[model samples]
Target: MSKKRYILSVALIILTLNPIFSQNSPKTEILLVGFDHLGQMDNGTPSSDIFSPKKQKEIIKLTEKLRTFSPDQIMVEKEPSEQKQVDSLYKAYRENTLKLSEIEYGSSETYQIGFRLAKMLNLETVYGIDHYESTSQSLLSSGKNIDIFKNGLLELMNTARPMKKKVQQDSLSIYDYIKTINQPKFIDLSHNLIFNLPAYVINGKFSENGTNTVDIGKIDEKYIGAEYITLFYNRNLKIYSNILNAQLDHNSKRIFLIMGQLHIGVLKDLLEANPNYKIITTSEYLN
Candidate 1:
């Protein structure tokens, strides 16, 4: 064989013999956009009205920017149980037959970011990947003397308050603001706030027994505060499972997830450990 033909023959043999090369597929590119809950997490502070003309214009620009990712699948913080209802709502929004703000929890970031961008991309549906079981609050209230490391948590929030105020004040456009919070620094800060709660341990550590009893102190061995925070973390883990199990096309290469800041850090940590995924940060495309 000629020199060129010999090299081509060698390459063909390698390609045919190497199962690794033959089986390789594009790594799924996932962008987890950490977002504010609009109002649910506002903690008595009302979020700026996203419904205003100025904010609406900013949202349009933000959606257009995210369109660059061309995600084959989009996930929201909503519960999977709401999937059917949200699909109908998304269809109504697409057909101009309904306004998201008219219904309950309609003005959530799921609609503002997930639904808005999905529609802009002309995608058929969005995925819901949240799991909510409200045991944290009850744990806090169940104990007779639940410390909650109250001072530490308070100090943490007080420190974060200024930055939170600036973001909520509309000092920056929606696009810029989302970019700001989704930064790795901010995501870490938001996540660490809850870890303080686990330090409020007393005697032995235990999770809820689901005995229909309110007083956990009666159990004799209870880690009220640790269990409180554990419940929150448990919910996030379930959310992670939902993301992994979401039904996407076999050929889908990109997934865009929009969820609250607290959940993002945990999810990012979980996703980065998986070799099948590549975590695309907000700074990448938004810039």
Candidate 2:
């Protein structure tokens, strides 16, 4: 019990507590909610009336569940180029000085979902991370390929687009509808509608499903199939880039992003690969 024993005991105590003090912080938390654009869905069918009393109740319920997440930043599918415009609109909305109908974006998910959630969380800024890219393609021949493409579109018309043809008349609430789209099956359906469809047909036969990676084929035949798929990936890739840029090294532990359901499949893979993020889903909250 001399000086040497006392020094050894002190060293052991310091070493044992170092790990507790210096442990790495957990990775950033991200929740990607693939919310259908409510306003746009009112096109063909006669539903998705967000302003309706019933739908408003559902929206309130949905946001109540999302409120638990209390995200520091809310990212929307709108383009980042409109940051100043969005900031102004959001500020007005937060201040209760703006009526959504007064603005063109009121019907957009950027307002219905993004603005609503940001307002609920009492957040100051909503980030727009969407990207646009030019694309060109079409069906030119009649064959099994055309049949497949038509069938895919039909399936989407029936299944993928939410709140269609009297959704209000039906029983499903907006909360439940949003929950359904966040599921993996719904995300896969969206991906298949685009990539798995027979987008490029040369002759009576069609290219294999998901053959977006084009090879150097005959000079006369352009790889329309690959180009079509590439366009989807390209736009989503740019959106991913925008998300990273939007993050701005802020200390946001949880970030909520609202995008088209189609984006979930691709962005999930991209964000999962990054070591700095830990991806979460609505399944935990919505269910």
Best by TM-score: 2
| Model 2 C-alpha lDDT versus the unseen true structure | 0.72
Model 1 stretches astray by more than 4 angstroms = 1-23, 40-47, 135-152, 196-200, 204-225, 247-251
Give candidate 2 misplaced runs (Cα > 4 Å).
1-25, 43-48, 134-146, 161-163, 166-170, 196-222
The best candidate by lDDT is 2
Q: What tens-digit string does per-residue lDDT give for candidate 2 at 1-287?
A: 99999999998778556632223545678999887777765543344566767777777788778878889999997788988999999999889999777778586677877888898888887988988553322332344356666676678778854454445554677788889878888888777767766455334433343333334234223544544556678788899988877774556778998887778888988989876678987898898
Model 1 agreement with the true structure over 1-287: per-residue lDDT tens digits: 89999999999889766642443645678998876666453344344666767667777787888889999899998889989988998999887788878767776778877888888888887888888665433244334344545444566566556655665676667677778778877777666656555545556444354322323334333655565566567778899888877833334579999887778888888888865678998888787
lDDT measured at residue 114 in model 1 versus the true structure, 0 to 100: 80
Which pairs of residues clash in candidate 2, taking residues 3 or more apart in a chain or in different chains? none
